[model samples]
Structures are given as structure tokens and as C-alpha cells.
Target: MIFTGSLNAQGFEGWFNKYLLPSLTRASVLIMDNAPIHRKSAISQLVEHTEHQIVFLPKYSPDLNDIEHDFSALKRKRMYASSDTSLDDIIRDYCIT
Candidate 1:
């Protein structure tokens, strides 16, 4: 979640190194957006250590990321076009996903 400021680089690194890496015996390729944090050296190291490759999606092209559509669908179907007035509301919306 990038809501704090920037994306969670170290957290992403941990997820990759500790969990996503060991998730599969073979190398896996990760497709991602071209966020500055995603291109940082630490994340690069994590990708290398995990034997997974990050294939960044083109800038300004959320259509290329499959999750974008899913998120839109979730917002449309569950949120009922309501503004996320609180953390609870946001969490409840995501639960419907």
C-alpha cells in the first residue's frame, strides 16, 4: 500500500525474499508498475536473490495490469460509489473483493 507516501519497498523486498521467492521451485517473473520505489536498488537485490524477474509495466498504462480491472470492478460492485470515509469502510469494501 502506497497510501503512506511511497510504496512499501522494504516490505515488498521482504515479501519477495521471504515468501514469494520460496513460493515456487522455479524462477518466477513479476510484472509491476514503474514506481520509483519499485526500481530501487534494494528491490533489485531482492529480485536477484529470489531468482525472480520484475517486468515493469509501461508508464500510464494501468490497463496492462490485470489487477487494475479487478480493483475497478471491486470499487464499482462493492463500494456502491461511496467515498471511503474511514479505514473501516475501505477495509469493508476490499472484503467484498
Candidate 2:
């Protein structure tokens, strides 16, 4: 289940307690994207004790996160063909490139 709000530690805490735990009866390993917040002490503690398995994908691999592709594509679409001369200009270029 995709947790739509902020992907921060607190958000994950709620997600874990609300959505993830209730489905524990199923039989399958949990495959998760490599996100620092997901590896927090609170979450790790809970996951470690549960029978539900978890796998963190390789670090620095954007291929593992589809959201990365979507965001990158959004950036590409927001940029312009003209070269940027300033940092803000570059940022704006990404807004409409």
C-alpha cells in the first residue's frame, strides 16, 4: 500500500501501525525501497520482532523507486531548451523545461 502523505518517520509510524500490521496473516516477504526513514529505530524494532520479512533495495539505485522516475520525468518536462545562467534560473528551467 502506498502511503500518500509525507514519507517521514512519523508518517511511516502511522502507516506501519495502521496499514502494514493488519495484513500480517498473508504469506509473502516485504520488499521495500531503500529509504532512510523506513529504517528508523522505531520501525526496525517492530519489524525485527514480527515474522513479516523485509528487504531494503540497493542504495543509490533509482531503478528501485518508481517515484524517482516520475519525479525525474516531471523535472524534464518542466525544464526549457535554453541554457540557464543563474541558480534560480536553473530552478525555474526545471519548472518549465
For each predicted model, how many residue pairs clash, with residues at least 3 apart or on different chains?
0, 5
For residues 2-55, could you state the per-residue lDDT of candidate 1 as single tens digits? 335444766667666777667778877877777665765666666775566877
Alpha-carbon deviation at 83 in model 1, angstroms: 29
What ranges in model 1 sit over 4 Å off?
Answer: 1-7, 35-37, 61-97
Tens digit of lDDT per residue, candidate 2, span 1-97? 7446567777777788788777778655777776767764676666786777767666777798888886786566546435545646655755575
- What CA RMSD would you report for each candidate? 10.4, 9.0
Q: Model 1 compared with the native: what TM-score?
A: 0.43
Quote the positional error of residue 23 for candidate 1 in Å.
Answer: 0.9
User: To one decimal, what is the Cα RMSD in angstroms of model 1 from the true structure?
Assistant: 10.4
